[model samples]
Target: MSIQDYPSRLSDPKSRKTETFSYLPSMTDEQIKAQVQYIINKGWNPAIEHSEPENAFSYYWYMWKLPMFGETNADTVLAEVQNCIKANPSNHVRLIGYDNFAQSQGANMLIKRGDM
Candidate 1:
């Protein structure tokens, strides 16, 4: 197949595309917990954000309250993720680990997919 033919296999343009992980199979809860643990171990602050499916690829996302600074408990971060999901059932929810030292995002992953 030619490179030009690749576009034909892609989903519709209007369809939702969250992030790199979206292309992979949906992650289980345990896997998500492990990721959260990894983020905490990296000394990154965890934050929850959500956006409409159409804006999934956009640079900005609505922050769920604020980032949990100095939060070491994985369960606490996971709970906030659930809260964001419940509040925005029709929007895509994501978890991001902000690196204060680097002043940028160190980790990002889609936790839930909204209705497309």
Candidate 2:
């Protein structure tokens, strides 16, 4: 089949990994909590976003209307994750941690619980 016929290959062995859980299985809530706590300890603020594009290569994304900063508690972070999940349950959702000191994202994680 031609590349245009298929948007993605589920079995691609060389899939690029850009974040902590990019390659392996998706993380549990506890794992996310611990990681977010770590980032908060470092004074980073977290943001959440979601999107449903025509293909995996699309660049379109929509940030949630809610604010992205000031919450450091793990439970709060996980709640936002759940909120993101609810908002875009069937598409791609991401949790990004921004370092105020560096003015750049330190953590970028995406999750999709079911087939696309």
Candidate 3:
């Protein structure tokens, strides 16, 4: 159920905070880097998105910045990630791969640099 349907006494048990990547099996730097490389190989740009509505129930996230595909280097991936994390510390952030030829693919929760 949406956050609105749930009661305020407690959080929803089925509440799925992150997508694509789980907090339990956090992704490693290498894995994330490889994924970024793959996206770059696919000629896609990296982007970040997040929600802004109050009550913390809105799932409609907006693009923090425009899709940047010029720099296909792996460093760009990490740079975008750092930028996203620095931009949205408290709010939820997602890593999206944008492409013009094909549909966009996004991997949620890619900012965890602690452990895999």
Candidate 4:
């Protein structure tokens, strides 16, 4: 199919779309934890903040294995997330690697779980 007729792959709530990935791992454990806190502090679901210490490490790996979220600029966001996590240690949180899953899935989870 030509590019014009290739059809946009963007996901629609009415129609589930297949996710894509760039195979790039971003952020460290500290960074993931930090981002999780950031997300939680922003009024996201506390459950999303819940994760095992290992989750922090596997987060990047999960993102690497997932075929979705793009890698571009993800590191920057991860850094910001880490900063947030650092600022809120007592607030248990976990950063779900956006680069590892479909943005739609993330959004749906956030909404469904009332994390956002």
Candidate 5:
């Protein structure tokens, strides 16, 4: 996958918060997502899809920046996603926008990422 496809897969700007990565110097979107997915794969499920909008960022925050290389938080979840991407970078690196209600290949990437 090309570098251009990285951001959208890493985040849905229309709904996901952008500010979390603003201060994380040097991390590409791909790396950030690898971090998040690895976290998810480890079993630390963040507060997913909460009803109150304000609480949403908490989930986003967890997904966006947990699991850095030397982080105290790094563990199985981050390792799993990192391994998947390392195993197949081209397959895991692309994103096609799709909401949960819609069914399509775009959603498959998340499934493939173990994010869904």
Candidate 6:
């Protein structure tokens, strides 16, 4: 067996990291608005959270604020996401749909990537 016969190493530093919707291209503002609408239609409370790139996968993410309970407007939720990104430009921002009945997260996705 020679090096030529072996496949390249699997450890590539340039490889992109994986997370929710990582496989898909970055979402646009319109696309994000659509998703927010879907969450509201599902009666899920929208919430924002952010974390440093290093802690992106940590169990605990810093909540932007209390979930927008009884929120019927998608724009309001999207605004909060923007606020979170502005406050934490160097951190990853995500939106979560909380199901009060299920008492857990029903949907989640990364809306912004950190500069670092």
Best candidate (score: TM-score)? 1
Worst 10 residues of 6 by lDDT: 5-14
Model 6 lDDT per residue over 1-116, tens place = 65433232335422445364865689999999998999999999999988887776569899999999989999888888888888888988888899999999898998888865
TM agreement with the true structure for every prediction: 0.86, 0.72, 0.65, 0.26, 0.23, 0.84
Span of 10 residues, lowest total lDDT, candidate 4: 107-116
Error of 4 at 92 (Å): 1.6
- Candidate that beats the other on TM-score, 1 or 3, i.e. the better one: 1
Score candidate 1 by TM-score against the native: 0.86
Please list all clashing residue pairs in model 2, or write none if there are none. Answer: none
Candidate with the greatest lDDT versus the true structure: 1
State the C-alpha lDDT per candidate: 0.86, 0.67, 0.59, 0.34, 0.35, 0.83
Give the TM-score (vs. native) of candidate 6.
Answer: 0.84
Q: lDDT per residue, candidate 4, 1-116, as tens digits?
A: 65443343334322222222112233455654554555444443222233223232233221212222333344454454455455544332433433223333232111111111
Instruction: Give the per-residue lDDT of model 2 (tens digit) for 2-74.
Output: 6443233546523434345665688776777777787788777877777663333456667766645777687
Give all candidate RMSDs, comma-separated.
2.9, 6.4, 6.7, 15.2, 15.0, 5.3
For each candidate, how many residue pairs have backbone atoms clashing (under 3 Å)? 0, 0, 0, 10, 5, 0
Task: Select the stronger candidate by TM-score from 1 and 5.
Answer: 1
Q: What are the per-residue Cα lDDT tens digits for candidate 5 across 1-116?
A: 65433343334533332243432354555665665555444443321111122333343312322323323343443455455455544331222222223332222123222121
**Model 1 clashing residue pairs (backbone):** none
Against the hidden true structure, what lDDT does model 1 obtain? Answer: 0.86
- C-alpha lDDT (0 to 100) for residue 84 of candidate 5: 47
Backbone clashes in model 5: 5
